[model samples]
Target: MDEALLRSLTPSVLAVLVRRGADFAAAEDAVQEALVEAVRHWPDDPPRDAKGWLVTVAWRKFIDTTRADAARRRREDRVEEEPPPGPASSVDDTLQLYFLCAHPSLTPSSAVALTLRAVGGLTTRQIAEAYLVPEATMAQRISRAKRTVSGVRLDRPGDVATVLRVLYLVFNEGYSGDVDLAAEAIRLTRQLAAAIDHPEVAGLLALMLLHHARRAARTAPDGSLVPLAEQDRSRWDTKAIAEGIGILQKALARDRLGEFQAQAAIAALHADAPTAGETDWAQIVEWYDELAGLVDSPVVLLNRAVAIGEAHGPRAGLAALAELDDSLPRHTAVAAYLHEREGDLTKAAALYAEAAHKATNLPERDHLTRQAARLNAKRRA
Candidate 1:
């Protein structure tokens, strides 16, 4: 059985049931049941039309479940006569599904979970494993999310920005357990891009590809984090980089510059560089300026400060950093780097130690500690 094919068909199949008057929760559950059946039987006897098979099986499952429920007596009348097994309707509701899964009514975590299950075609257990949470916990989160959107009608358009934000959140999760959420987010975003003609969608896909292209060199053999400037360029995926650059170029040409596009521009700039020293920091600072204007985020400005430090001088970067709140994440680390560049080894070492103490994860803390040690040893020499 082609698992990818099955997952690809899941959203459209679930959408068919929902369009045919099934509630979102019941329809999603029924679609999952259909997927299980496919996994069990498709190996011995694959259907000619996968989507149609799923739609038929899922609709029947929904009807059966609705009929069995005492509280859903009124819903039974609508699902009493199951549609005959035939080709599923070609009316794609995947875009609508994306918007619904990212509904503002749901919390960010719930939205990500629901998008993975209902849109990305992932199982609750898979999502649970990826998030390092209990299966029961993830199940409850998805259940609540489905219930929250159950009453919402898919008659109006959804907020595209919300959908993009949810996808970005998924991408930022990177990888955990058996699920590479970043890859899953890319796949789902690709699906969304196919459904909608939005430049931001294309921009997001480009950004994911560019970032993912460098995954092989992001860590050392000891699983230690490697800074971008130190990563081996030979390890990068050239194919993915080329593809990302192409997509980004097309999106930029459309003249609809959103935050994602601006971000992709920065990623593309990094990917374009053949060596760390050859990076166009000035251009990157300009992109960061554009990104800051688009989002008004402190993190964006923080990053811009790094680019400014590289583009101009360490003192200039320090000047930019001083104007912002020092409480931002990674603020101390950036300060350390800038101080070190300004030939203030003692101050840099102290700041690195402080950043390590504030680190949120083990790898980051270890990396920062190593930086402090290196600076202190240099001073001793």
Candidate 2:
């Protein structure tokens, strides 16, 4: 069975059911059943029309489920009469499904889960594994998300920003378990970009491409974090970087200047450099200023300080960091780097040890611990 093909057909199949008067939750469940049946039987006897087969099976399943539930008898009459078997309507409902799954009513985590299940065609187990959560917990999260948006009208205008934010969240997850969420996010974003002509959408796609281009060099073979400055530039995907730059240029020309566009500009500048020393830190700092104006996020501030350290000096970076709350995630890490740059090895070592203690992930904690150890050894020598 072609798994990718099945996943690609999922949204349209679910859309067809919804258009035929099925509620969001039931239609999704029926479609999932159809997918399972396809996996079980398609190898021995593949259907001539994959999507049509899925729709027929799923619609039947929905009808059977409605009939089985006494409380849903009232809905039975509306769906009892099945439409003639054929291709679903040519009008693309997939885009609307994207908007619905990313509805503002749902929390960020809920929206991410629902989008993965309904739009990305991922199983709850797959999502759970990717997020490092139990399958039961993910199931409840998805169920609650479906219920939250079930009452929303299909034709309601969706906030594009919300949808983009969810996609960005997915991209940032990188990869884990069986799901390459970063790749999945790119696929979904590409679909959305095709469906709608928006600069921010293009900007986001550009940003993901540029960032993904460096994935191969983001870590050492032993899984230790490789700071961008020390990464082997030869490992970066030049093709992806070129594509991202072209897209970002077009988006920037549109003059919308959204946060994603600003961020992409910074990424593009980094990608353009042959070495860390060659990077245009001043341009990046300017872009960060624009980003700070667009989104008031602590993470952005933290990043801007790093750029300041490169563009001006470690003292300037430390001054900027001092304005931020010390409790901010990565605050100690940033301070440690700035102090090291300023030649205060003792203070840097102490800060690195502190940051290591506060690190949330194993890779990060290990990296910080190594930084402290390296600095401490150098100080002793």
Candidate 3:
């Protein structure tokens, strides 16, 4: 069976059930049942029209479920009559589904989980594995999310910013277990971009492509984190970078700048450079300024400190860093880098060790620890 085909068709099939009067939660459950049937039977007897098959099976499943539940008998009248089986309606409610899954009523974690399950066509187990949570925990989260948005009609527009933020959260997850959430996020974003003509959407896609292009070099052979400056540029995916640049240029040309577009511009500038020394830090600092203006986020300012250090001087970067709260995540690491650039190895080494102790993940902690060790060894020599 072509697992990809089933996943790709899941949203459309579920949408058909909802458009036919099924509630969001029940329709999604039925679609999942249909998928299981397909996986079990498709290998021996594949249908000529995969989508039409899924729609039929899923609709039947929905009808069966609605009739069987005593409390949902009232809903049976709405779905009693089934549409004649034929080619599935080309009217794509996938976009509407995207908006619903990303509805503002849901928390960020709930939205991300629902998007992966309903929009990204991922199983609760798959999503749970990706996030390192138990399957039952993810199932409850998704169930609650579905109920929260079940009463919501798709007659109006959804907050695109919310949807983008959800997708961004997915991308940041990178990969784990059986799922590469980053790749799944890129796929779902591409689907959204095709359905809508929004600059920010294109900007987000460009950003993901550019960042993904460097995934191969983000880690050393031993799975340690490699800073962008130290990464081997040769390992970067030039094709993805080129595509991202092309998309970003078009989005930027639209003159509707957003935070993602600004971030992509910074990524594009880095991708354009031949080496770390050749990077146009001045342009990057400018982009960071634009990003800061677009989103009042201290994290952006913290990053800007690094760019400021590269563009102006170590002292300037440290000054910018000093303005932010010292309790901010990665604040110590950034200070360490700036101090190292300023030739204060003693302070830098101490800061690196401090940052390592505060690191959230194993790889990052190891990288920071190594930085401190390297500087300490240098001092001894």
Candidate 4:
């Protein structure tokens, strides 16, 4: 299916069509046409200027569609042969495309779907697979997202931040479905960072890299979640780690310290240690504290509890965790860790079982279940 050709051409295809002034609907249709053409032609004559050819052809096709639709005749000249001179000359249209895909007017799910389609060059079926939904469901989602943004004006400056956040979510899941969402996210974020001047975008890229560096060690081949301390330190991606640290250091020096920057700081601290034992728990706790203040989310608080536990004592961690809601998903797991640390193996084993049952994903469930099994094995021994 000309996979490499498609992957290489996709970002540019979407970007050029959009930059030529096609709205989401038109740009999407144009890119789809280009894909169909690629499938038909790439076996014989691969165009020399693949991206340019796709963009030029898609732009023309989009213009034709707009002209034929009586309703769209009002702006037949919506796009000029060449765009006017603008701010940020070095800025690429791909960044603008991200903002459009992540337009707040669209629902979060829809935004994700659109971004996958437009930027990731994924078909509707692929997006549906990742989201664990039907292809038809995801198609409707993309379509609705397109229609929702048709009326909204989107050239504002603040739009880039929203775009960066949406991409951040894509990277955070690490991996999903058949696609490596984390890799796709890193690719897109790099595109955005290169095209834009925003420091937060750089910060998001740094954060994604830091988290992604740990992915190889995050899970075992059997799909078991590897605890941070148990992870094979050698498996960590040193290149991603170095890049993350360099970018993070630069962002921290800016003194903006946005939420993304704070999270990156925490990740950087963890990555700096030779082993989990060598981790700067005190600094990590401080970063988590800053993050909690910036985002005010319970998840951050729960994570901070773990850091506090490492920095101080298990009992202190438990005390901090006690302040959070019992309904939180991390509730039982944190309790089990605290109990185990405080020398209550029996109670800890019981809590581990509960945590396993409550776990959301397969790896996490398996991890907690194994924790219980270890404690059980000790009893039998």
Candidate 5:
């Protein structure tokens, strides 16, 4: 099968159906039908007009589905029964698909899952694998999301903020089974930045790229976490750095700063320096200040603590961390980080293990666990 061609056409197919006023469920069914048809035909007879073919087949499938379910009332036929445009759809179709998938009405988890499935052109199994959830569970989640959006009125106004949050979640997830969440996040963010004029969206795209550019050096070969100070500068993706810088510059010019824009500014500062030692920690602290002011989220404060360590000292950072609510997730992780910085490996190792126990995601928990193991091993060695 022409997998690349299918991937290329998937978003366009969904976007077309959405534009034609099919609610989310009907549109997804249409795309699924197009996918099945592609699998059947592409190997034997690859079409020169994949988009047109999918749109035609999907349109027919949507009509068939509505007709079969006598329960569903057919809406007024608003979309013209027009032929497909000459040539294929522009890449903007993919952006539209993400925007539609991340529609605000859907729950955040549902929106993320649907965007990965529809715009990301990934299978339910693939998404399931990525999030470390059972395939059946992910299937149910996606289906439930579809049902929720089925009868809702279609709105094209991009949920830029929600889209950014979804993309950030994808990026921060690091990696997963058969899916590179960071890479996917970058792709989705690029599409979002292109499709929307929101500076914060652009800021998020830049931040993801900036952090992603360093992914190679962020983990040891055995999957152990590597602190930023120890990461090899040569391993960073220079092209991604360039793009990130460009986006950050554009976002900064807008003057209407949001939390994401401030975070991007911090990432940009880190990326600009050739060496870790050269990072403008003072400037980063300023941006973090702005971010703290923008959102009262505990994670923001936690991040600010790390930045305080960089700008001030470990003792000061630990002091700042102490002031935060003890009930927050990652509280122990911040304490462990600060303790590790303070030359108190004993306390750090114990706290790291505690952090691992409290961590929400597997990668982060594993990382902290490994840190504790390494420290224990080092004491013996």
Candidate 6:
């Protein structure tokens, strides 16, 4: 009856099917069908062993589908001898599932969708709603992803960095519809950290926790974006922040510096601050330097500019920003903030208006529009 429990068991169940010689695509479909049946029946007739129940039902479903398909006739003979229903294997297949779902053959969007569905146990409609896309469009994307990875061998190890990137992408999506993707990403990352002793894995989990701890204060009552410096720190989850800092500290001790660890180091600094004005921007700028060395992303440079503005002065930040491409997303907004910090009200207002026109999301556009209006009003007064 516990939906989260069922979803959590999904990847392992599918892995069992794949291990038993079932193809990935068919095994995934069977697992989904079993999940639907569980939702319909589990509340009224709960099973003694949830994972075993799912494996039995899904394997039968796989066999039935394979037998019906002439193209899969070769698989029908092997699956005809159904494995006896019993307790699920003690061996954890969740890690392999993570690798398989984040396989490099698929596009980023496709990988995210497949990971959510096959590993996260989200339905296609749920994923579509979370992404604010049409169900059919999401369905096609997931289908293509499955086909792309169908030929891939599950026995081989997968790239850890690719898996981390996929998880980070999920975390950055925040929350929408019925899924809190950020929390889901944290859960999966925690699972990954337990399975592997990698510092980057721990680092990513820490970063997610630190960011998620501030979710409550990230928006106003009317769903308006609240700048980090302006957020009410009283609302932040102290426990999560503490845990994040602890995890980050251990990862940092490992000395295997990675992008996520660098980012978490920055987040820990922010959380350590008693107030916005007390933030250690100089240390943060140093961390940004590390992050810049890890990746040459323009967004990272833009963020470093903001840190420079805080650590040095507005003019210094402007100088750093001047080296980046003007067409980058949020560049104008960053420029506007720097100009405002320099007390150039007219330039700030105009830049804010321009940024609002180019904003990608509703909340951001509304926030930028308000900034522009506030500055325009100030100029008139």
Separately for all candidates shown, the number of backbone clashes (residues 3 or more apart, or on different chains) is 0, 0, 0, 0, 0, 0
Candidate 6 residues 29-124, lDDT tens each? Answer: 999999999999999999999988999999989988888884555443656887654355423477888898999988999999999999899999
Question: Which residue ranges in model 3 land beyond 4 Å of their true spot?
Answer: 70-78, 84-92
Pick by TM-score: 1 or 2, better one: 1
Off by over 4 Å in 6: 70-76, 84-92
Ten-residue stretch with the least lDDT total in model 4:
82-91
Models 1 onward score TM values of 0.97, 0.94, 0.96, 0.89, 0.85, 0.95
lDDT of 4 by residue, 73-191 (tens): 55455454545333433255566667778988877778888888887788888778887888898888988888987766546544777887789778766666898888888888887
lDDT of 3 by residue, 132-180 (tens): 9999999999999999999999788788899999999999999989899
Candidate 1 per-residue lDDT, tens place, 1-381, comes to 788889988888888888888889999999999988989999999999888789888888898788889355544355687655435433348888999999999999999999999998899999999999999999999999999999999888888999999999999999989899999999999998888899999999999999999999999999999999999999999999999999999999999999999999999999999999999999999999999999979999999999999999999999999999999999999999999999999999999999999999998999999999999999999
Tell me which residue pairs clash in candidate 1: none
Better of 2 and 3 by lDDT: 2
- Using TM-score as the yardstick, the better of models 2 and 5 is 2
Pairing residues by index, what is the TM-score of model 4? 0.89
What's the residue-level lDDT of 180 in candidate 4? Answer: 82
For candidate 3, the per-residue lDDT at 24 reads 92
Evaluated at residue 61, the lDDT of candidate 1 is: 88
Local distance difference test values of all predictions, in order: 0.92, 0.93, 0.92, 0.81, 0.80, 0.93
Best-to-worst order by TM-score is 1, 3, 6, 2, 4, 5
lDDT by residue (tens digit), candidate 5, 1-381: 757557656777887777766776777867887888888988899888787788888888887776665445555544445544534444556666676677777887898898888876778888999989999999999998877666655445566677777778778876769788788778767766766678898888888888888889888898767878888989999998999889888888988898887887887788788899999888887888899899988888888898899889899899889889977888898888888889888899999999999998776889889889888787678
Clashing pairs in 3: none
Q: After superposition, how far is residue 142 of candidate 5 from its true place, in Å?
A: 1.4
